[model samples]
Target: MEFAAVLLAAGASRRLGRPKQLLRRDGETLLRRGARLALASGAARTLVVLGARAEVLRGELDGLAVEIVLNPDWQDGMAASLAAAARALAGFDGAVLVLACDQPALELAHLHALRDGAAAAGCAATEHAGALGVPALIAPALWRDATDLRGDRGFGAGLAQAPDGAVWRLRAPELELDLDTPGDVDAAIARGWLDPA
Candidate 1:
């Protein structure tokens, strides 16, 4: 269970008006929420990749026991941020649970399931019923792809390219919703997600 939570928060939230990670929901920003969830999920090392508003988000992560990696190539896309974190954990073992900062629905339980699923797969992705989900855990055998990742679109593409049947599904609701717009935030609020306004 000694895994790393590679938080991909380096995206430019051009669609969310401002940085979505900074928008407060339930008295916490999305970036903080993702970091905290990763911590609660038994992640010994939580590496958050920051781009766009890296400095602004850095203050939010203060004292959270999370490591920060600023992705200078973040503007290129989310893949750059993932590569930054993957390189940071070049020699790691166990599972790497990847997550997006804008996803408030992600919870500790979901991450645990991802870990369990990955462990079950042993050296590959744990296949599931739905599309490959994250908090998806990628075992060390797949770490090479993560580290060598380029561009955006996340490591899932590599997983997909790996020959299929390596994805694990956790049937958790947290993976269903990702708050990206003001309306999404409002919907999450109405659904009792949090006062993320």
Candidate 2:
């Protein structure tokens, strides 16, 4: 199905003492890798939401040919970036696969599964944290709700409010692996995230 991908590049890695999105893994920085995946996955468009140190990431994404949105409120949290990206895809059909920049290991197949599932449900999410965490395929019907996401409360909370059994869950271990700490990035290196570089 045709769709867009929202890469969340906003957020300062206070724990890592550096911008996680700029962290290099196998020559390609996390932000670039994520954007490349979204693009390679056939996303109609890939909108990157940047915040805090957005300048550092700009160089890496220079020739990527992506739609970049600066989130001045990014320091506030992921919700702000989500809102920015949602607004970017307001008129697009299909769903938006929301990807956290820190997760370089998230497989493209995982996104495909969610997109396939969401082709009907208006919304579908990958299984993470024993439930759903992201890599979601949010159909256009819910664009308003997605763009209205506020504060730290986001689509995850909204999807949960689905009456009874309204959400489809896809099992994906990679979806749960998020690079939040220096140690996490170090661990990811073994997963071939850093490769020979």
- Candidate whose lDDT is highest: 2
Q: Write down the lDDT that model 1 would get.
A: 0.72
Off by over 4 Å in 2: 163-165, 195-197
Writing each residue's lDDT as its tens digit, candidate 1 over 1-197 gives 56888888887777668787876667888889888888887877988989887887899998899889888998888767877888888777767877787766666767776777666654233233444545667766776676566665655666665554455556665456666777877777777675734
* Every candidate's lDDT: 0.72, 0.76
- Which residue ranges in model 1 land beyond 4 Å of their true spot? 123-129, 161-165
What value does the lDDT take at residue 117 in candidate 1?
A: 68
Q: Going through the candidates in order, what is the number of backbone clashes in each?
A: 6, 1
